[model samples]
Target: MSSLWEYANPLKFMRTTDWLLPIVAVAAVVVTTTGLIWGFFFTPDDFRQGSTVKIVFLHVPAALMAINAWLMMLVASLVWLIRRHHVSALAARAAAPVGAVMTVIGLITGAVWGQPMWGTWWAWDPRLTSFLILFLFYLGYIAMWSAIDDPDTGADLTAVLCLVGSVFAVLSRYAANFWNQGLHQGASLSVAPGTRMDWAYKAPLYTCMVGFGLIFLALVLTGTRTEIRARRMKALAARERMA
Candidate 1:
């Protein structure tokens, strides 16, 4: 257990993360492949919406993760800000892009699905507007990271931005609750009298979420490792300059 726990420290983490990369990568591939094949082929069509509704399996989960990922970064950033943990800071940085990608996926998929179901593809409905705000938060967070010259300063700015973003995510999730009406129907799976999803659809939806999550973990680790290496190289070069 002690040996296992040491991996939290940067030095020990360096020794272990590379070994786990292949394992996580393989799991991501297997889950994604199986989930997509089953979801695309075997899942039953929606009674009302028909085939277009299939996009929900992808869109809903990605939207869920996008919001959740920013929350994760908020927590990680808080820890980094308070405790000054390098790994936590790196993790916050790495998670930003993944969350942004997931947000884009959700928005694009939702738009595509809406065209056939709703008369128009776009609407300034509460849910849609709040989600757009959430997407902008992701962009702002990424931009803060890139704008600063000192990486530590960038981390601090982005951490504060992440905290603010978490607040927005909460607002986004609840925006529908506040509104008198919504373009989105209450979730079938998540709400009361939950969706009657067939087993085939349920299985793949969960598998895909798991697959995407693993992919996120793998990418975060890879980015952290690279950040560490880059820092080390910079330090060594500085030492040579001094020598």
Candidate 2:
């Protein structure tokens, strides 16, 4: 447990991720390409939705990452607040943009899917509404971090914001279940006895999910490394001025 905190050192974290980043990047490219190609070309179209179902290949994974990214940030925030870990705070900072991009992808793909299926581009349904709220939270988190000049103060404020925003993020995830009447469908991937998706779609969908997860990991690592370097540069500049 004590050893784990050693990674909170920025220089150590940068050195470790240097090798890791390229591996993750290559894996992300290969897996994402394979999954998207397989899902798009090989998978059978849905009898009900037809080719529009192909959009699911992008939507589901993005939505999953969108929610999971916030969860990751929330956990990182807690770690920073409790342990005063610089790496944890920077990790939370690094994850925000990736999460925001994922949220945008989810929202846009969902709108595309909705237009064909629900006959409207946008709906005020509980699921959609909550997701929008989640996006707003992401925006607010990013903005809060940028608004403050002091790194420590920014970290503290954003960590608290991340904590508070987590409640809404949980609510967003369960909104579909809570409001069954919403136009949005239920879980597409489940391990339950009776699953809605067939293996034909499920296989590639899972693959894409894995691919997106890897992509998220790669992006976070790269962003965290960049943040570390920027902080180091800032510290050096401060010292030079003091001299």
Candidate 3:
């Protein structure tokens, strides 16, 4: 009957993660390797895009995570703002770099995919533009946290920044649907049977998505543990200096 919030304690969180991190990390590696092998090798090429279509396994997953990681941070930021949980704040901080990397991967892969298809490497497409802006917001969020010395104050400011950046996150996900003029296609793995991917492509794509999600979870856990230890060390150093 212990409440979930009990894990908010730094010591408890560390203990839980110590056991949990390795499992998630190993699963991430196994699943990601399996999905990539299945996707890149076993799968046949698309009739139109040919070999380039394989890139979707990576691009789609990264793009999805890029937006999802921001959503995770937004939720964590809210928890910190309302509950004043240090762990929540640190989790949000940890996710920024991961989310930023996902955004970069999405952008790069999209450009690579677009060059032949769209006759250009870049475009002012609404989704692409909004995704780029989300990346910038990630950078600003990370920088704002580093610039402020007080953890609580920094968390407060960054929480507000997260709220602001969420607008772009929403736009990034739905801009293609809103503006039909864009080069980007609709969801590759939609629930609608008509729009969903073929079984050959969809199967491995789903696997890759799960793998990427596991990888993100493992990374955030690792980052949160490091941040917690660093905070502990800093507090100890300050106490020694005061003594």
- Candidate 1, residue 93: Cα displacement in angstroms equals 0.4
Task: Write down the TM-score of every candidate.
Answer: 0.90, 0.97, 0.97
lDDT of 1 by residue, 1-243 (tens): 475335547887787886998898888888877777777787888888898867877887788788888888988899889988777887788888888999899889889999989977879988888888889999998898878867788888899888877877886677777775878755446544546766666778888888778877787788888877776786798889999
Full candidate order by lDDT, most accurate first: 3, 2, 1
Q: Whose TM-score is higher: candidate 1's or candidate 2's?
A: 2
Residue 79 displacement in candidate 3 (angstroms): 0.4
Best by lDDT: 3
Residue 55 of candidate 1: its Cα lDDT? 87
Which ranking of candidates, highest TM-score first? 3, 2, 1
Off by over 4 Å in 2: none
All models: lDDT?
Answer: 0.81, 0.91, 0.92
TM-score of 1: 0.90
Q: Candidate 1, overall lDDT?
A: 0.81
Lowest-scoring 10 consecutive residues by lDDT in candidate 2? 1-10
Candidate 3 versus the native: TM-score? 0.97
Report backbone clashes per prediction. 1, 0, 0
Q: lDDT for model 2, please.
A: 0.91
Kindly report which residue pairs in candidate 1 clash with one another: 188-195
Q: Cα lDDT for residue 124, model 2? A: 88
